[model samples]
Structure formats: C-alpha cells, structure tokens
Target: MKWRVESSNMKQLAAVLVCLLAACLADKPQPCTSPPLLTGAFTVSTQNEELWQYAQFIYDALGQKIRMKDLGTYDNQSFTHDVLLLFREGVMYEINDLNRTCKKLPLKADFHPLAIPKDAVLLGQVVIGSSSGPGQGLLVNTWTGDIGGTYMMTVTEFGCIPVTTVQHTNKFGWIMTSFFNNIIGITDPSKLNPPDFCPDAMTEDVTREPADFWSLFFNK
Candidate 1:
C-alpha cells in the first residue's frame, strides 16, 4: 500500500510539470517565415464604407514579385483590374483587361516578408474554433505595430499563415482590413509572370511613394 501511494504521488507531480512546460512553450513567441511561393484569395474592405474588393493573388517572394487580380464595387460602380508589383524592376503594372492596356508606374516599395515583424508586440493568442478536440480549432496569434502606419495582424500559430490584417493611417484617414483565404503553394511559376501586353505598357510619369499604392485603390 505504501509503495502504491508513493508511485501515484510521483505520477501526479510529473503530470503537473508537463502542464507547466507546455504553458511556457505556448507563451514564448514563435516567429515564422511564410512559404516562398504562394497563391491565395483575399478580401479588402474599408471601415464604415461600402467600398470592398475581392482579389486572387499570386506571390513569388523568391523572385520579388506579386500579382493581384481584383473585381470590386466602389461607389456602387463595378470595376475590375490587375496590379502587378515587381520589386526587382521597381515598377508596377496596372492592367485593364477589357481595354487590353497597361499603365506602368515606378514602384519604390521594397519587398516585405509575410512573417511577423521583430518589433511587433504580441497582443494575444486565441483559438478560432473549438479547442476541445484534435483538428477542431486553429490557434492564432495577434500582433500589432507601426509599419508606415498602425497595423494589427492575426496569423496561425503553427504555420504562421496570415488570417487577417488591419491597417490605419491618421494622415490619410485610411482604415482598411484584409482577410486572407484559400492560400496554397504556387503550382505554376508562369502565373507570376507579367501579362504579354505589359511589354508595351504605357508609362505614367507620376511620382509615387510607397504608401501611394494603397491610396490608388481608395481614392473616393
């Protein structure tokens, strides 16, 4: 009887230790890098505004390029276009499919990685769904910081997949939220290439800052 009691107490102590260790691991910040090549869909919306857009995106971090095809209703008018940013070439191409025309502008923004910034403050961690069973819930971390503007981001804890991002800028009165979905590794490398018409794109000689990219879509 005495031996059994000691063994039971040891088991309980070991269980407690395991729980503490797990808690510590979860609390520790885990910074992760996104996959080099990916394709996804996202929705962007402005706060207190009817303006919204749904876009399919192809990202090639390794090649320093990204492309977005979007259709949106702004001010009750439907519009569609494709924007391609080539970091290496320092240029952006805005393509109008219906007119078969492309406008080329200088893009000075550097490539920003999808991972959480080192200076970002962790807001909290939460589960999206039920955490009671395996494969039931997605654990995610929320981070906030100023990157040109105030921004908050939520990403999956395990794979560091971006779930949503909210950005605000006081100077521009801009508040936008974006939600990501259907993200997967890029299957066709050719999808990252600019359209054939881009070679003959008309150059727009307007000076643009990096932040001007967002303003291009939100000009109401």
Candidate 2:
C-alpha cells in the first residue's frame, strides 16, 4: 500500500520524529538505505566545474565510499551534473557549479512540502541568508498525503546528516538533466531510478539496481 500523511500535523510530526530519532541514534532505525551513489546530506559544488574536480574532492572526503564512479557532463564538455547527494527520510541536497552558491538546493520526497506557502509556515521562517532574490524557492510540509506521482526536493545544508525517510536521488533519475525548476519533486515513475546512493551506506533490506537509473545526458 502507498504511504499517506495528514496535512495538518506535518511539521509537528517531522520535528517530533527527528528528535525521537536523534535521541535513539545509538539504537538505530530502519528505512530505505541502498544507493548506487553517495546518499548523504552533501553540498554539490556545481559552479560549472568539471567532474574531475569533484572526483578529487570526494576522494579527499570519502576515500573508499565510492568504489566505482562514472559521471556524465553536458555536451561532452563543461560539467553539467555537478553532484548527486542522498539523504534519509526521502530528503537530499545538491548545488551545481554553475550558479556558484545561489544554486544550493535540497531534495525531499514528501508531497506536502510542495503545498507549503512561504508566508504561511512559522518554522520555515528561519532566515536562509541567501544571496539570490527574495521570497524564492519552495518549502512544503511533506509527510501526509497519497503519493500518486514522483517527487524530488532539494534543501541547502552545511553538513551531511540522514533524516527520517529522506535520501538523495542523485544518479537515479532523469531529473538531474530534464529539470524544470531546481527540485525534482514531481515526475513519472518510469523516468526515475529507485532512491540509491554510495559509500556502501546500507540498512539491510534496502537494495538497488543500476538498470533502474537513466542518463538523460546520453542519447542512448
């Protein structure tokens, strides 16, 4: 059966759950955890830099998390897919080297998040200190709803931490290339690969297949 959430108690639930989970990190909680790429809260330096530079960065941060790697760029030149990060509770973050720091974004898997209005919510009022225009980007309170379509959200983060039910769908979908806005929250299942990541971060039961992913940057 598909998961559903209540529109009202979304934020409270998320906060309470996050707290409970954090208190019990020593005990361990289970969700989905097997990804082909690195699935953690990370900052994608998408400043139009080459994939080779990111390769070196990852190698410095995570020596063996990525055993095998194959990154595709735009037009066989310039870097297009800057970074692919995964998070827990169906959430993830990424930033392209194109827009420097303005492109920092987060990817969340809940539907309610899309329905949140910037002026309506209180918790979301935390000043982001962004350099871009004012009153931009989307932040919806996800968790309560009948998910019939595919969704991807990107939230900027200073560190990598797993959240309840969020993961980075970096190299698992065409959203990386065929994107409308910055986030990939809505799409067809046929076009997305399962939530997968790397660094061998697994919680058992959660598995992945590379065949599930599609490379829009490719013509195949």
Highest TM-score scorer: 1
The local distance difference test score of model 1 is 0.77
Model 1 Cα lDDT, one tens digit per residue, 100-199: 7778887767788777888889899899999999999999899989887888888888777888888876543455655566466877777566668776
lDDT agreement with native, every candidate: 0.77, 0.28
Model 2 residue runs over 4 Å out of place are 1-77, 96-99, 102-220
At residue 209, candidate 2 shows an lDDT of 20
In order of appearance, the predictions have TM-scores of 0.77, 0.19
**On residues 24-119, what C-alpha lDDT tens digit does candidate 2 reach at each position?**
884332221122222222222222332221221121112111111234444346443433323233322233333442122233222221121232
Off by over 4 Å in 1: 1-27, 97-99, 171-176, 200-202, 207-212
Output candidate 1 Cα RMSD: 5.3
Task: List CA RMSD, all candidates.
Answer: 5.3, 20.1
